[model samples]
Target: MTKKDKYQKVAYYPGCALEGTGHSYNRSTKAVGKALGLDLVEVENWNCCGAMEVKNVDPKLQTYLSSRVMSTAANEMDMDVVMAPCNGCYHNLKKAEYDLKHDPESVEVVSKLSQKAGHKTYEAGQVETIHALDWIKDTVGEEGLKERVKNSLNGIKVANYYGCMYTRPRHIFPEKDQGPGSESTSKPHFMDDLLAAAGAENVEFPLKTACCGGAHTLSDSDTSTKLVLNILKAAKLAGADVIATECPTCHSGLEMHQIRAEKVLGETVDIKILYFTQLLGVALGLKPRKVGVHENVSDSRGFLKERGLA
Candidate 1:
């Protein structure tokens, strides 16, 4: 079937971060889906994707963790597609899928673990994993977004920040030539295209796939702060009022470090950080609370209110 038809309903996997600091992303994602007449069936009995410390410590262990999540979706839920909002989760699941298919060691480890844990082992090609960006972009094209926009973000200048992830070493991403979407490794523009469809002007920001240093946030505070500050400063210099992010870690890192940089380094960059889903929700005329904009670490209600969005 067509992507517009197939992706209308899929397994939604909101990783660990979404329930905590990235709650705004969770809320806004569901809100935008509802506004657009789409359906999402949450995955059952999900687990972490091992994008955190587990991966560094044990690579196979990380692959196992990600495999379990996909296992529940495919084996139990009988799903053909799994949608992840966080980039880390998306990247991890894709990595696990790739590993299980190609690497005999990963398959052997996961199989042994699944047998011991009394759960079905996840086999590759059973389900297709996609980012939330892919879910909406494939199902709802730019024209669909433009048709659904209730409040035009005509005056907003946005700098789209796609974090440095999804660089699947196995080249496991689906073929981009099938009219699904373009998966440009060098410069991904799904976020930019979505915002532009909502009437926002995307700035010429050079940092598309830059690292947000989220993995080093706790382990190295100064380094994380410096990395975040560079992104904030560059967005400001590009005349962007907001830096739109898709990943929860990247979103929270931008929000938290934006505050830390000001208090610690005394470098205050006056730019609002928002999830792209939150921006899309507002453009779709959903209330601020509906999109959890007020729940963001850095408040943008006043800023959006000034522009008649709130």
Candidate 2:
């Protein structure tokens, strides 16, 4: 079938952050899906996909964790596709799929873990793992997004930040960089395309794939602060009024460091940080509150209201 048809009713995996700090993304993603008449059946009894941290302890264990989630979607939910909004979760699930297919050691470990955990072993090719950006861009192309605009994000300058985990060490994501209409790892533009369709003026952002230091935000606060500040400053220098984020860890790091930069370094940078999903929800006529805009640490309510978006 067509791309839209394939993604019309996929299993949703929001991960742990979505239920906590990333609730706004969760809300807006669901809102956008509903507005577009798409069906999102959440993965049943889903658990953590070994989000960026756990893999440091044991790669195979992390593989098993992600595999179990995919197993549930493919075996129990009977779904062919699993959609994850979190970059970490998306990356881990994709990594698991790759490991299970190519590495016999991974297969053996996952099989043993499945038996011990009382679940079916997740073999590769059982389900397709996709990010939220892929879900929107593939299903509702730029043209489709343009047709659904209720309150256009006109004149709102956005710097689309895809973050590092989405595209790094590219072999895991073989689907990307294939041809036109496919995602590019070197210069990803799915978020840029979607926001532009909603009438947002996407700035010339050079740090789209930069690391937000989310992995070591706590362990190495100084380094993460420096990294986040660089991203924020770069966006401002690029004439962006807001930094559009796709990952919860990146979004939180940017917000937290924006404060830290002002308080500790006394380097105040006046740029709002928002989720791309939240901006899309507003453009689709959903109120800011509806998309949990108020929940964000970096307040953009006034700025959005002044632009006639709130």
Candidate 3:
């Protein structure tokens, strides 16, 4: 089948970061998907879910707001699976769907809220929530990904970082979903597989799924420093040359604030962090800047140069 026929109607949810702070994420995901033969159809009228803070302040209100966004994909656009590239949006949308489906009171409250926002009705299973990483693993396949690897990540060790939100709330994630073959959440090892396919050595990181403190870095700086430091330390201990992650939040938290983390943690370690999509783009024979490798705080250019890819 042709590429258009393969993914005739895939919904791409850019979320808040994809447009602004996480703009690189949308670009990289779109580029990688296109290179690997998946035409990503982004949702046109999508909005933000306000991440954890909104849900924490008022669960009911947050659910209503999130439901409206999901309803847009379901009722208005008629999408089967809404591929959320951002972890925050993925979790928020998944949570709202679950609450509306399982709890009648929540459903009724959110229904009215949806109407207030000019929406018809929010239904359960309207749009199946999924992460881009999961979709890439399934549609692209290991062998297909292998074929796209033009340049191997030789002599470079990678540490896979999966922050919070990407994998939580047991309800949205199926038991089998956690497996390599399922479409449940963002699998860091999926990136590892792609890296390995490109002939790179993926360090078996013990703290691959560890939290990177996210926005908490702003409020609880000390605790956040420790969290970021530990993950970096884990990567260093495992002999990783660079840390790789899919979430932009994790990338910002760890990479953008490496200097601060070093001062707080009392050690200066040489490490760089890159988004998993950027790495995938490199493997797909795309230029580094096109995939957002330049946006990172660490000089990832050197990593690419050493490998003769720059």
Candidate 4:
């Protein structure tokens, strides 16, 4: 089947952050999907997809955790595509797919763990994992989005921040950088493309894939704040009123540190951080409340309302 056909209805995996700190992202993503006529079947009995903790401690164990999610999607739900909104979850699942295919050790460990955990072992190629960007871009292209835009984000200037995990250590993502009409790891444009279709101005922000210091937030708050500040400052300088994000970790990092940089370092850069999905949801005529715009620490409800995007 064509990709357009495959992505119309797929398994949705929101990971842990979506349930907690990233609840707005979760709501916006679902709201956008519904508005676009896309179907998202939540994976049954899903588990964490490793994230930073398990991967730091044990790469193999992390593979097992990520694989478990895919196993449920493929074996139980009979799904062939797994869409993860969080970059961390999408990355871990993609990494698991790569590791299980190339590294026999990861395959063996995951197999044993799956059996011990009382689930079907996740064999390589059983399912495909994609980020929320790919899910929308592939299924509903920029043209599709333009036709669906009930509330155009015409006046909103945005800086698209992809963060590290989405494209770093790029060997795992064999689908990207495949020439024309494919996502570029070095300089990703999927988010830019989607927002532009919705009538938002995507600024030429250079720090698109730069690290947000998400991994070091607890261990090194100062570093995390500095990193986030740089992104915010750059976005503001680029003439962006908002910084659009796809990952929950990156979104929250920028939101929290935007305040932290002001309170602690007294270095404030006035800008708003919002999930790209939320922006799209609003453009598609979904209410600001429907997309949980108020849930974001860097509230954009009034900002969106001022422009009639709410």
RMSD of each: 1.5, 0.7, 2.7, 0.7
Give per-residue lDDT, candidate 4, residue 236: 95
Per-model lDDT: 0.90, 0.94, 0.76, 0.94
Clashes, model 1: 0
Relative to the true structure, candidate 4 reaches a TM of 0.99
Model 4 C-alpha lDDT per residue in residues 60-107, reported as the tens digit of each score: 999999999999999999999999999999999999999999999999
- Reference-based TM-score of each model: 0.97, 0.99, 0.91, 0.99
Q: Encode model 2's per-residue lDDT on 11-44: one tens digit a residue.
A: 9999999999998889989988998888999999
lDDT of 3 by residue, 95-180 (tens): 88888878999888987877776777878877777677667766776787777788767777888777777767567665326564
Which 10 residues in a row give candidate 1 its minimum summed lDDT? Answer: 168-177
Better of 2 and 3 by lDDT: 2
Deviation in angstroms for 228 in model 1? 0.6
Model 3 TM-score is 0.91
Q: Which has the higher lDDT value, candidate number 1 or candidate number 3?
A: 1
Q: Which ten residues in a row have the lowest lDDT in candidate 3?
A: 1-10
